[model samples]
Target: MSIGDGYRAVVDLLRHLRFFVAVAETRHFGRAATDLGITQPPLSQGVQKLEGHLGVRLFDRDARGVRLTVAGGRLLGPARALVDAAEDLLDQAGRLGGPVRARVGLCGDLGGWTPVACRALAGGSGPGLVVPRVAGSDRLLAELREGALDVAVVRHPGVVDGLVGGDVVGLPTRLLGADGPLDVPLAEVDRPLVVPPRRHQPPAHDQLVDTLRRAGHDGRVLEAADPTQRAALVAAGAGVALETSPGAQASGGLPPLRVRVVLPAARERRPEVDHAGLAAALEQALRR
Candidate 1:
């Protein structure tokens, strides 16, 4: 018998599940320590403890490096699955009331946003924004999946293949007022770009990256952690950013800026996916 056998015999275990999984994935104790944001000796001790409890080897450890043993490779799949299930459970728990709140992503200003959309979600006919400020499409969608938001509004380049889309359109094409010609091979170097994180980047990020890459220039992307800071950076001409704000008419105290609200090009049009279906599905999940 091995430490692994004893470890798995219990109906449940705490803490070490993640640590064990990390060791199996990375193989090296030091590297796994770094990934877990801890130190090397502790990670090694924990893995040893797991092995001792299970009564079998989980890793082939040596000075050269670490690799998962047969037992570990077998356990890795199930362990990873467990982690995913736990995350999904947490996400479903965080949703709001019966109706569920939907999030919409706005690429441009809100002049084109219909009032009907806002009123339906606000749960009343009071004076308020429809989508409010979601920062960007990625943030809104993450909220949507996590049950924080039931619906989201996003611009479609028609490239997002799997998830359905609705009201697809490009945004106003505001030129950032370059010192040179509008179309002259533009490039932003060292300047900060206010954009979504790679993990949560929206269709807009992809399109913008493509555009910059085609022009032989890589744009710097600053994650949208702080909307105000991101906005300020863009305003100062430090970088270009995608934002959703109340239209100029509604933006009372905000600085006056002229931006081209470029709509999606014809090739970028996406088919309308039913918002009703998404709402229904979300509601059912919360009930359970």
Candidate 2:
């Protein structure tokens, strides 16, 4: 295609990418239409137009509704970025002389250090507004990579390309039991293990799994996407919960359980930044 033709095509793709993203996230035409405040037919047509422009099928339709095709999956990350960037552009245009805004993502409080970090960032005399988002580690990391987030606090945040982490704090790991504190050895506990989902932070999960295995545990492991839910499970005698003591306490009031330090400490995931200013700010926050 000629340069002019390619440019127009790109513009057209941008126009319909929002519809594609809505459908991909909702996975249902009707819901996507409702969310987009448009009729189902037009929404479907817009998606079709996008598919035609890209020359790839974005979704597979069946009685089970819609599912993203492999091509769709590949496009999802970029599509989301396009939509976010468009929104940001509009926001920035509206706020033309306002302070710069910084988007921050937090992965489930990062063992109660999140609040402190927030305070540190807020206390900064810098000329930027900080907006925070709370989400799972995996989702936070993905957004961070996509430029949707300026900085993020995640658990066991190893090394991410293009981003450097700072303000590392060691979180003391604990095991909680139901109804009260129990001194039961790891090998003696037979209940399921209720903890964060492994996919969100595999390194931390693997370390926990290895520790349990060494203690002779071969029971079922239950995945809890939220820390409060995991603590609730422990309170109900559903299973044992392994997490930072402060994090579990921050989750909410729960049934009393025996608490023991299974691991002396695990480092809290702090801000992953691309700028020296952000790194310095986070380091200052960690000191508080």
**Residue 112 Cα positional deviation in candidate 2, in Å, after optimal superposition:** 2.5
lDDT of each: 0.48, 0.65
Model 1 poorest ten-residue lDDT run: 254-263
Off by more than 4 A, model 1: 1-120, 123-149, 155-162, 173-194, 197-199, 209-224, 235-237, 240-288
Runs off by more than 4 Å, candidate 2: 1-49, 52-88, 94-97, 124-129, 157-159, 166-169, 180-184, 245-277, 280-288
Q: How far does residue 282 in candidate 2 sit from its true spot (Å)?
A: 3.9
TM-score for all models, in order of appearance: 0.38, 0.56
| Residue 209 shift from truth in candidate 1, angstroms | 4.3
Question: TM-score winner among the candidates?
Answer: 2
lDDT of 1 by residue, 21-95 (tens): 877877767667655545577677877876786677888867788888899888788878876676576657634
150-244, model 2: which lDDT tens digit per residue?
66666663434345555455454455688755556677778878877888777666766766777777746888887788878889888987555
